[model samples]
Target: MRERDIEIYLRDEVKKIKGRAYKFESPGNAGVPDRLVILPGGRVYFVELKAPGKKSRPLQIAQQKKIASLGCEVLEIDSLQGVDEFIAKVCEGK
Candidate 1:
């Protein structure tokens, strides 16, 4: 599926887990993850949605590392099963 389709599916699944997923945009912050997802209990995750069988761009990977360095979890999702597993893991919590 396309990146947008995966994003929509993941956002809908997030809602089922009582979370909110917002399209992330930042002025002058190119390569940032596509979505900022916040779950119950203040857990937060940044998601970069990609087309099936695709990988993140170099700059995208750099942005993910930058975000992770600040102590937030970042997820790269490219499939329906990835979204399902992400939802389940988030709901379960760590």
Candidate 2:
């Protein structure tokens, strides 16, 4: 599916699990993830959505590393399966 479709599915699934997925944007800091998902019990994560077969750019990878350094998880989702996998991961240990 398309990137937007993946994002929409992800957001909807997050809500079903009683979480919130916000569109994330950093004006000066480029390569930020697309959505910030917040779950119960203080669970938080970042997700970068891309079209199927697409990969993260170098700068996006760099930014992901930076975000990881801050102790936050960053994931890249390129397909519907990826979104399902992410939901499963985040929903674990809840």
Candidate 3:
């Protein structure tokens, strides 16, 4: 799916689970993924919506690697179920 489509999907999915999807913006640009999702009870995460069959943008890839190296969680999703799984894992601490 395209990035815009992914954003809509994520926004709706977050709502379904009572979480809030916050798009992380920068003054010039946000090289990271399009959003940071925060759930109730202090659950939170980063998700980059890379199009299906397309490679991640160079800057996003670099940022993701950096975030990983720093011990942060970044989840990439394609289908709705993947988003569901991301929330479930974050909520369950699995």
Candidate 4:
């Protein structure tokens, strides 16, 4: 499946568990990741979805690390299952 396909899948799945999901779309964000999901309990997660065999761009990697360093959570995942784990931990309001 394509990245968008998987992204939509993840969004819907996460919503079922977390109550809401959002995708970030800036007019000219050249290197930002695909989505930002906000859960019911006021927590946020930055998700970068990629197809199998794909990797994050350098700037995107740097951004993810920067977000993590700020004590926020970011996930770079290739599979929907990995995304599920991320949602459960970061967005599911456990």
Candidate 5:
């Protein structure tokens, strides 16, 4: 139940739905979300992956809030079930 394991699962599942889960990194931008998920029909999301029962750090929360202020979707996926729920919600009606 490490963070990387959850990340790999999300990437694999997103691929199954023909989406891309990119490792998102911004140099000099500490606390940015970990993944940039782009689904079909131009749906995009910024995803922060954490270990099971782990919460985001304060700076991460700030970054996520800034992204949300831009009217974009931000997700915090800490488990495989979270990934599945994300796909089911966003990929609905596609």
Candidate 6:
């Protein structure tokens, strides 16, 4: 599927679970993740959506690494299954 399809699915799924998936943008800080997902119980994740079989660019990887270094989770979702897995993960321990 296309990246936009995956992103739309993700947003819909997250909303079904009472979560918020906001379009993330960092002005002058290029290559940040595409979405900021916030779930119940204070769970937050930075998500990068891509087309199937696609990979993040080097700058995106660097930005993700930087986000991770600050003790936040960064998820790269390139397929429908990846979005499912992410939703399951967010629902865990609830």
Index of the highest-TM-score prediction: 6
TM-score of each: 0.96, 0.95, 0.77, 0.80, 0.96, 0.97
Please, what are the lDDT tens digits per residue for candidate 6 over residues 1-94?
Answer: 7899999999999999999999999999999999999988998999999999999999999999999999999989999999999889778857
Q: How accurate is candidate 6 locally (lDDT)?
A: 0.95
1-94: candidate 3 lDDT, tens digit per residue: 5767867888987887788999877666547867888887776677887666666778878888887788777877766667667767765763
Residue 80 lDDT (model 1) = 91
Question: What are the clash counts of all predictions, listed in order?
Answer: 0, 0, 0, 0, 0, 0
Tens-digit lDDT track of model 1 for 1-94: 7889999998899898788999999989899999999988999999999999999999999999999999999999999999999988876774
**Residue-wise C-alpha lDDT for candidate 4, range 1-94, written one tens digit per residue:** 6787779888888778745667776575556667887776677778889996689999889878877898877877788777767766664345
The lDDT for every candidate, in the order shown, is: 0.92, 0.93, 0.75, 0.76, 0.95, 0.95
Q: Give lDDT: candidate 1, residue 92.
A: 73
Off by over 4 Å in 6: none
- Please give the RMSD to the true structure for each candidate, in Å: 1.0, 0.8, 2.3, 2.2, 0.8, 0.6
Tens digit of lDDT per residue, candidate 5, span 31-92?
A: 99999999899989999999999999999999999999999999999999999999899878
Q: Give residue 75's error in model 6 in angstroms.
A: 0.8
Of the two candidates 1 and 2, the one with more favorable lDDT, higher being better, is 2
At residue 6, what lDDT does model 2 achieve?
88
In candidate 6 the C-alpha lDDT for residue 31 amounts to 99
lDDT of 4 at 69: 90
What is candidate 2's CA lDDT for residue 22?
100
Predicted structure 5, TM vs. truth: 0.96
